[model samples]
Target: MKKFPMTVGGEKALREELDDLKTVQRPTVIASIAEAREHGDLKENAEYHAAREQQGFIEGRIQELEGKLGSAQVIDVTQIPHTGKVIFGTTVDLINMDTEDTVCYQIVGDDEANIKGGKISISSPIARALIGKEEGDVAVVQTPGGGVEYEIDQVRHI
Candidate 1:
């Protein structure tokens, strides 16, 4: 499988989740399944069915996390040399040319992209346009609504 880029923090978060699922959730589900099995009737038991469903979901998630963790290339923003150019895991300050409104966004991995947290996916239109561009450069992004232009004000590796 191809390796995916992930920020150091994002990779750590996934690792923590994987650990929790393996140590806590897996045991809890196993215990629940065993308890449900003790209720006797296997075919018509609603509790048993629910426990089995929960087990399936937990197992699936564990496997997914494991796969992602195995193939993730974790990039630490702090370790990157401070360059004015925009790059992955760099926080960028931008000003919308039309509205004159300033917005800050950190380019991050797909799994860690959260607009509310000021993180944009690396594959996003804005990030793609901003990549390798230095401060004071304009990035023209094609949004769903319309074309938007943003002027890069600063780039910080944080």
Candidate 2:
């Protein structure tokens, strides 16, 4: 099976969600189904139908989390050795050549990517272009808005 690459934090979050689903949601939904069964007629019982639908959702989520956790390959960014080059889990500071604006982004696995948090997926166009590039190198990314060049100002494996 293919391994799912993820940061330590990302793995922890998935674990927590799985725990909550198993320990809390599963039991709660079971109780709800049981309670709905007490009201008699199975065909016309809205409460029973609703509870079953909710149970389905809960079970599907539980399975998805389990499968993902089973194949997760957690990586620690702080432990990786840095050679002044951009790599997976490295945070790079870049300066836009045209706008002269600075942006810092942490190259992370898909599961750990949150653009709002300044973490970008390694497979993204910009990240792909930045990989293997050293500080002072200009990386060009072809975005939907067109090509943009960014000069690497600093690279930190954090």
Per-residue accuracy of model 2 over 1-158 as CA lDDT, tens digit each: 99867888788898999899989998998998899899999899999999899999999998988888889888887898878899887899999999999999998888778999999998999999999999999999999999999999999966
**Candidate 1 clash pair list:** none
Best candidate according to TM-score? 1
lDDT of 2 at 7: 80
RMSD of each: 1.0, 1.5
Tens-place lDDT digits, model 1, residues 94-143:
99999999999999999999999999999999999999999999999998
Which candidate has the top score in lDDT?
1
Query: Global lDDT of each model?
Result: 0.94, 0.91
Instruction: Point out the worst 10-residue segment of candidate 1 by lDDT.
Output: 74-83
Per-candidate TM equals: 0.96, 0.91
- The total number of steric clashes, by the backbone 3 Å criterion, in model 1 comes to 0
Q: State the displacement of the C-alpha of residue 24, model 2, in Å, after optimal TM-score superposition.
A: 1.3
